[model samples]
Target: MSDTSGSQTNITDGQQVQLLERVSVAVVTTLPCCVFLFINVTMLFTLRSKPVFCETSRYVLLYNLLFADTVQMALGHLLYLFAACRLFLTYPVCGLLILLACFTTTIAPLTLLVMSLERYVAVCYPLRHTTIITIRNTGVAIVVIWAFSSLNILTRVLLLLEFPFKDLESLQMKEFCSGVYVLLGPRSKDYDRAFICVLFVSAGVAISFSYFGVIIAARSASTDKASARKALNTLLLHLVQLCLILSSTMFDPLFMALSGILTRIVFVRLYRVLYIFISLFPRCLCSLIYGIRDQTIRPVLMQHLCCGFLKPAVSNSK
Candidate 1:
């Protein structure tokens, strides 16, 4: 009897420990997410506050990129909270969340692709850049990116026809809500892998090409050395950002493979760490990179970030 009682106590203690750890992880992840969301929102407002940002082609593209990333970050964080809380949402609800998440996730790389090409044009053909990258074209490009991503989402929804949700006792999911559970069919998996591969590879090649083009342009006698250098740095940053964004998509499969080798406790701990780095960190990169690097945006972003305190001083100085 004493042995059985001791075992029960140990099990209860272990469960409590797990619960505490889960809560701790959630708090740690969420605090940074909230901070980034605040900064991103401020940056978005800063972009729209000035006429120059609205009129410029690159700023327009940056707005689109940042918008998609902000949505992605929010959805991803919400989904993470859902999983952390062990909430099993119904299929329809989960599907909507997952689809929205996937849609925004798809936009990041594609936007980066467009932004890279924009930089390439700016550096390689400075005279033609203004004509080629106009407001109308930027708007059209954003529409194309959204339309393409919508097609992918539509295909995934169609693939759901194969899932026999009718066989289940309820629409409520048996497991925690996630892309892995939501997309169970073989075709969905194959399609997802193929689509991700094609999208990332194309973006990678385009960005790389733009990087090289900028490097070559930098050496030319006619090229503005400073502009070429800046474009090179921007392209390089885009490549790094692309890789970080890509890492979030790859983490699930990698973690799944690691699950077999690692114990549950270790796996959960490692997953949280990777989740912070892979998922959360990448989403914040856009604001941090452009907010600090872009001279035009820095002062406005700072003013907004400081809650307009700098605005009065700047006006007084002016």
Candidate 2:
């Protein structure tokens, strides 16, 4: 009787392990990549169909945000997939991925900050907005943002290359390349943490001020209630999107901290699931916030999709 009970317990454990493995793969790798591809493709098609959308500063910023999100999702998820498969990655390839990831990571929040400022100007200084946030100016802002992000990422990469790996086997390039591992010593880790915190805090403060200024301006505009309402709703959407993106950034460090407490196998599986969720969830929110929720783009997207479906049906009848 005891032997039979032990056998049943072993079978249950095996089934649970299999279940976790399947879940990890699906959540960490397959779902995020597929969803990001679909949404980004849809966004590209929508923009292509209506080229005028790119002319507006708001749309241009939003489109760039989408592009950044797509790139980040692609790189992060590909790395996760490789890690899951236990595949080896060359240093150059891994460094490139890390560089791109850092670039996108820096871009996302900065773009959100830009968007917030754009809305603030449009609402708070309606008369000056046209002069301030023109196509040329927006393009310049984007270029500056990219340059700033690249500089920061480049500095980090250079610093990472300088870190001594003599004492730490796990910090070796090959091991660090497999996952989102950084081989920073205590001092380096503190610096990295400070840099990230400062960056996020500054952006957060700017975003908060922008939104608050918009609210005050909107409230004072008693002549155009409809426009005020629309502006408020749009600002609300931006706030939600900012929160989602910020939350996604916390997952990696959070998982690393939690791993020390959890069993190894359990930590690995949970980290996989959480990592993909972190990468993909904000992207889905971005699609809804910028694409589907927008007054201009949503109609074009829906029309394109409908036309695509009806084309096959009409051809079949012919």
The models' CA-based lDDT, in order, is 0.89, 0.72
Best model number under lDDT: 1
Quote the lDDT for 98 in model 1. 90
TM-score of each: 0.91, 0.81
Name the candidate that leads on TM-score.
Answer: 1
Q: Which ten residues in a row have the lowest lDDT in candidate 2?
A: 309-318
For candidate 1, write residues 1-318 as lDDT tens digits.
999999999999999997997799889889999998999989899889978899998888888889998998899889888888788899999999999989998998999999999999999999999899999999999999999999999999999988887888999888777788788699999999899999999999999999999998888999999899989999999999899888888876787789899998898888888887898878887788898888788888888899888862332110
Candidate 1's C-alpha runs over 4 A off are: 1-19, 311-318
| Residue lDDT tens for model 2, 184-290 | 55655666678678778877887788867766766674425565566667767767776777777676678768878999889986876676566676776677656
